[model samples]
Target: MTSIGGAEMVDWNLAVATATRLVRPGPEVGRDEARAIVAELREHARSAEEHVRGYTRMFGEDADGAAAPHDTPVLVVDRPGWVRANVAGFRAVLTPLLEKMQERRSALPGGAVLGAVGGKVTGVELGMLLSFLATRVLGQYETFAPPSFDLPAGTSAGRLLLVAPNIVHVERELDVDPHDFRLWVCLHEETHRTQFTAVPWLRDHLESEIHAFLAETDVDPSTLLERLHEAGQSMTGGRASGEDGEGSAAESRSLVEVVQTPAQREILGRLTAVMSLLEGHADYVMDGVGPEVVPSVGEIREKFQQRRAKGAGRLDQALRRLLGLDAKLRQYRDGERFVRHVVDRVGMAGFNRVWTSPNTLPTKVEIAKPADWIARVHGDAGN
Candidate 1:
């Protein structure tokens, strides 16, 4: 099958097949019940956007001052469908970087031979990773999905995906009101859709940051091997102790952290800050819009937070740590605090200034210290 690097760097089809094969099945219900669940999720997804827009007061307008209608597509998909959409997104975004890496790999002696085998191996690894994630993600707003002819005229290509089975599974697990829980999930996902669609530059800005990060790749075989070794050590709890003599922090570094160069780390920091803002803002909006509409919102929030903290078994927890999912969990808490603080101090209008331009976006430090972001973005006006 065709791929970013002619199947030399990754076999996209193999990855999808592998993920679909390995992903655990979602919770089961009768055919009629399943149909009902999907229908309910779609209904909630459509209406959730109105609630999100009403609360956040954001319209899907471009930064160029060109007003566009909000017609972003919404798909209520099962686990395998979620996997396919994400694989497509990954392939699209990683295409340029993979092509560049392929060029570098081809220059090395015996590189062509290594690539043929490496492609299959990498594809399998990616599939395994996606399989793990496929079941966990309840919904997502795909920021980098390629342009589609199916989208309406003047509509952004971004698509919102709701993993119907997982949502049902979580609601069952949490034993919360199915209707309340479903709407709650949509509120968060729709907020993301609004964030990207409202601030048109956001999607492109994030894509550029990702491309910039990928462009800094060290494709040398030896460097790649070293990163693998570092990752192994990280996974095995082998990092050397720091001055504190505990080495806890070093041991806790994810595979994502072990593989990065200093340059990539700087970019990662910036990306992290941006993600923190997005996730936090969504979380804030969900809760902010919750009490008024979702009667069981308080219970859902309490139980969901507990579930996130509880996590899974030892192996799963270890994988989560290595995959940087733990860092992601922190992003929710930190980002929400940042948004809440800024909104509490300066109001939503002041917080909206962040979307004015990339320049107004918070730096990594400013995310942790909202006062600084307020001071910098709003100057004396914020005070």
Candidate 2:
């Protein structure tokens, strides 16, 4: 890690500014209606926390018996606020990668000059990426948010964000009950919050994995230049280096997939396994909540799965693929199946062992083979 002029590799402030400017406005509502929506979302989040804890058996015998030591704060935000929060998260978690990029830049002949211009260019690119995501995400538990007043009582625990407009927009699009939809969304998000807050070491373990991944980046100056050139060509309607005909498999790969080294790919596999487990666990918890809690739970899941399968418009779909979001979609399905299989084979208590420590978590191969994870973690006792 190296610093040139004591400045960051990506201009984060500019990233926020660019994203805010480009992001689409949320569905319109009256001021009072907006306030009501925000308030209800907040209430739903709190209530969902209780339901998630009870169903997942995360806290204790009684949902209230053993509360999470640091209850993460919930923030109901619009698109711009979500962008800002994610940019903060990106800056915090990506520090090592940024420093690595800076080191690469410094080794070049005109390194300082490259850093100055590259920072803003990278900022704009990041901003464009965030703008695309801001509208689509319904809720996110920002695992890497920097410590700030955003956390309750100044605790460094992460914050749960409910994107009010996205929630409203999706419910309307799906023709679902807003109340049930909102609560359903909260249930998924609250499960993530509980996973981190209740388990304690989860967040730090994830952060370490991310840092480890970034620290292994070995992109040289020439490779960086080549990637930038390829990116420029793609942006200007030119085919990428090896892109051949329409619907080529290579064309669907994201920049993330294209640039990884073998070492980075191995680390990414581990990270993917962890993320899959977390996300799958959340989906399992949400779906497992009975109809008494979310009356339209079945309808919501059905419609949402259809919507996810259909995805957005062509250009949006292309962007999603470019951003590696399509892989994220796979994680949900695969991870959920993995969780479902394990829970059926063993039980909730046996499944709980996955959260005991990092070692107990599934490997990438084991994620696809629940039997392997069970054998490794629980042995035949689970049988």
Compare the candidates by TM-score and give the number of the best one: 2
Sequence-dependent TM-score of model 1: 0.88
lDDT of 1 at 272: 97
Residues 294-363 of candidate 1: C-alpha lDDT, one tens digit per residue? 9999999999999999987655665677678988899999999999999999988778999999999998
Mind sharing the TM-score for model 2?
A: 0.91
lDDT of 2 by residue, 1-383 (tens): 25576555777888899889988898988999999999999998888887887788767543765655436779999999999889887777777877777776787887877777777777776777788789999999987777777564446578899999999999999999999999999999998988888787888888787788777777664455444444444544556434555564236667667658888899899989988998898898888984868889999999999999998655565566677788898899989999999999988988888989989989999999999999988887867
Indicate the residue-level lDDT of 4 in model 2: 72
Q: How much is the lDDT of residue 361 in candidate 1? A: 90
* Local distance difference test values of all predictions, in order: 0.81, 0.81
**Deviation from truth (RMSD, Å), model 1:** 4.6
Candidate 2: lDDT of 88?
A: 80
